[model samples]
Target: MPYSDKIERRLHLAALVFLCLIPTFLLFARGAADVSLVLVGLLFLTRSTLRHDWAWARQIDIAVLLLALLMLVVVVAPFGEYPGKNLSRGLIWVRFVVFYAAISRWVLVDKLAIRVVCYATFAALMVGALDGVYQFITGYSLLGGQGMVANGNRLTGPLDRPNIGSYLSKLAFGVMALAFVAREQLGEKRPLAIGAGVMVPVLAVIFLSGERAASVLTLMGLVAVVIGLFISGGRARVLSIFLGAVGVAGIGLLLSSSDRIAGRVAALGAVVSDYADSIYGQLALMGWRFFTQNPLTGIGMGSFEKVCRAQQPPESLQFGCYPHPHNIYAEWLASSGLVGTVPWLAFVGIVIWAGLRLIRAGHTQTVLVALYLATLNASFFPFAATQSAFSNWPAILAWMSIGCAVAALNVFKRSCPTTA
Candidate 1:
């Protein structure tokens, strides 16, 4: 039932690795290549089945799964201009369901899934970084790498949007994961915290991605670690040293990179000073308008863009209507409506409960809890839903991660009967 012993349990680690890689980097999959991902998933699933790899198999999360199925049914029901687009949207939902199964059932919670995800994420970043630099040198994407996902930004790192929400999401998990690794290897190893320390520069690049919510999340995560440290009875001196060092370094970097880092310095200031009447007031009005119009089934699922596009005035000064409500809760209420919101809330509550169970069990598996929570930062502050990378993947991953976190806690409790 769990990933206990290899003899009794079969390992599909290889197949699971391919699942994350094959259909990935949608930047590479414009049209035909996109189909390859589905093929790849099938291939991996088939390979594992043939090998009798049922070690990590577990029951699917029924609530999330059914809600997902419901969403898919609505998306491709075929009442729109872009049937193909609807079909694709429908398939993305399917992919989320399939991926949830892959991660929780086959990825094998112990450590492998997180490692593969972390490696794949960093690999994507490094490749994007190189491509961005190349674009800078060549005068174009050459292969059509436009934004961060395309390779790199001209001045900052390679990212598609000005706000690197994806990078921010990734970095927050990466930092927490490193911390988990550090605490585990305390005895005979050099400080694992050193790697976490070095990661500051890479995390800085995430900020340069210009996602304001992500910046706020980063600060909040640090505060979490401080609280965690204090609650665990850590020495005050040790906590002070780490916090002080991180603070000083953070401040120094902020001051040094004021020029190339355009968003934090320019975007916020411009919004507050010259563009206040246009941005915040307009956004607030839009939020209010959405609530007033669709009080019950609040626009259909995945209809925010349709609503935003339809509602905005031609001469409005705000940015083009976004496909999502910046606030995820609003996005959910707006799109999925009350029908979708109930199941989502239930799922989230169960997940949080699972995580809390783990923290109480032991420190070892607590990393999974931290990683899931950190990634949900975007879900809380919502972004464009159409961008599968930032939205669905993390949302799906959160519930799946909880499935494993709960499993880990179970294992821990059994290993030490005292936990019961």
Candidate 2:
């Protein structure tokens, strides 16, 4: 092989390794994941430049550029409380843009790279789920017991909290996408077995973690999958039956073992009744207050903790001020205000619109991409509690998925030129 060809091959291999490790790194060492992503992104950019290949730039939609510009405005607007912190976070956003561009380029150029990523994600989920189960049975995970509950009642797995469920839910979407792709590539029997095998453990872990948002989103994703299968035709009956069985079994297992799940469901009404008194409710109120007070520019990025302390009521003080409103939309409005939020909303809207269009087009690969994007949007729906959108893990995952979907759409257009 030519020297340039060999170099390109090595670069692709390195990219694949880093891509595969993203979920594992996010699970164990988030900081490391960010660093690795940065390196991979730079390498991709270098390769593209050296080869004089810039077509991938066209794959990037206007919404992403507008979002980036909006973030830059937030960084320089002098509205945030902690300029340095906001600047740091802003740099991370730029990193994600670079990461997205790089990943999209890779997906567009390499037919099988995205499949490898899906497989890697599935493997990571299985390992993480098993670790959570182990933690439940023993008093410790393979990593140790720092975050694991000793009673084996509530499984935190490897993380310091039950937040693992949210991450697991995100990965479950990837697994579902993989199963969809596998059904086309590897035939019906194998995909059915793969889907069931991967999903059951994932649902079990989500239930064991007892995170209300994660569990709800996961169930909703399952429902969406069944609907998609029904709409797409071809053995819909068998797939629906299989999915129904898995759903029933998963719910039954949770209801039998997890009092936390039952308790959360039972308390939902009471929690809603006394909305202003709850920690989440109070934080959300604070977010709305910030947005209303500074509708144009808001309090500023990374300023929520400081502002929350000053703005929160005396009763809310007992629950404590949080770094960001535990809600994605509220955090955007509170920190960046209307100026930052409009573009953010547009970005999400475009992604959803594009995903729906792809699903309507009826290609298996594009449909999987659409499903993944749909699941992601549902996971971070505005009314639900969520991690900070500007936070490292959430930001990385969100942008990465967007980039992948965009790239997949590009590939779909190329393969079916009529679609373009």
Candidate 3:
């Protein structure tokens, strides 16, 4: 091979390796994840610039432009309490869109890349599950630390925080998408079987991880996959119903197996019963106050705690100031108000609509696109309490899902040319 060709191949392999390591980064090394994210984007941009191959931007240009517009508004919106902070965070946020484009157009544009990423992600999740379960059973992790968080109610998995369940929830559907794609490759004889096998364990892990938001998101993602299967019209529909039952049974067994996990699940009822007095409710109400106070431009990015601490705390017994309102929509409204919220919503809508269209058009014999969309759905799931959407961890997961959806569409377009 020519020297240039070999260099290109090496760069290409590096992109794949970094892309595959994303899940591991999410699990253990967030800083590395951010670095890898930028590297992938820079690699794509470098290659595109060198070759003058800008075609990939055509599909994503609108979304990227919208993000730029939002960022510009964020930086210049004079009403914000922390203009300097918002300016920096807002500008840096555009990297996520660039990362999305790279994943879809450059890194995962083919079947081989898709398989590599899927298998890598699946393996990572398996490792996480093993680590979390081991800690739950033995009170310590293979990673050499106490594996429980929240007084042993939550499993840390491989991470040092109680976010293992949330982390796993973010990637569960993507791995299931892998299962679907694998089944398609195997002629679909065991499509539901493979999906259910993946599903039951994931569901159990999420439930046992003792994170309510994760549980809700996992169920929601599962529903999305089921819907996609039903639309495809095959034995998948029947098998989906069976899978649901098995999932429920698995959850029941998990709930019965440990009182700590079960009590945590039961606590959801208490939270709901007096939601107005719950911490989540208080935070939501507080966030709404921030939006109402600044109906156009929000207080500012990363200014939630600043603005929050300035006022009296919520009346709930669990009242405490948090970094950001523990909800995606709430955070958006509180941080950027409608000015930033509207465009962000539009981008999300576009992602969902475009992914759905791809699935409906029969681009793939698998439910990969559906599950990728599901991952996004769970990522921003409105009703579920979650971390700030703009924060590093959740933001990376969400944008990664969006990128995976776009990449999955491209893979299916190339691998399965028939459109229904």
Q: Give the TM-scores of the predictions, in the order they appear.
A: 0.67, 0.86, 0.88
Candidate closest to the true structure, highest lDDT: 3
Candidates in order have lDDT scores of 0.47, 0.68, 0.73
Candidate with better lDDT, 1 vs 2? 2
Best by the TM-score measure: 3
- Itemize residue pairs with steric clashes in candidate 2: none
As for candidate 1, its clashing pairs are 147-159, 147-160, 148-158, 148-159, 148-160, 152-158, 153-158, 164-209
Question: Considering summed lDDT, which 10 consecutive residues are worst modelled in model 3?
Answer: 186-195
Candidates by lDDT, descending order: 3, 2, 1
Measured with C-alpha atoms, the lDDT of residue 204 in candidate 1 is 55
lDDT of 1 by residue, 1-420 (tens): 443445223335554455445323433532422343344345446645666664433333544655745653563224332444544554565655554455444453445444454455445544544444454456444455453432343222343343334444443354344335433432312222443544455455445554555555665555555545544444733774687587668756865865544545565556546533645445544554675575544555455567677766535634667655555556555544455556666656655565466577655444445544554443443432223222543444333334333433433344446654
Pitting candidate 1 against candidate 3, the one with the higher TM-score is 3
In model 1, the runs with Cα more than 4 Å from the true position are: 1-11, 19-62, 71-91, 110-156, 163-165, 171-198, 234-240, 256-288, 309-313, 316-320, 357-372, 381-420
The full ranking of all candidates by TM-score, starting with the best, is 3, 2, 1
lDDT accuracy of residue 321 in candidate 1: 71
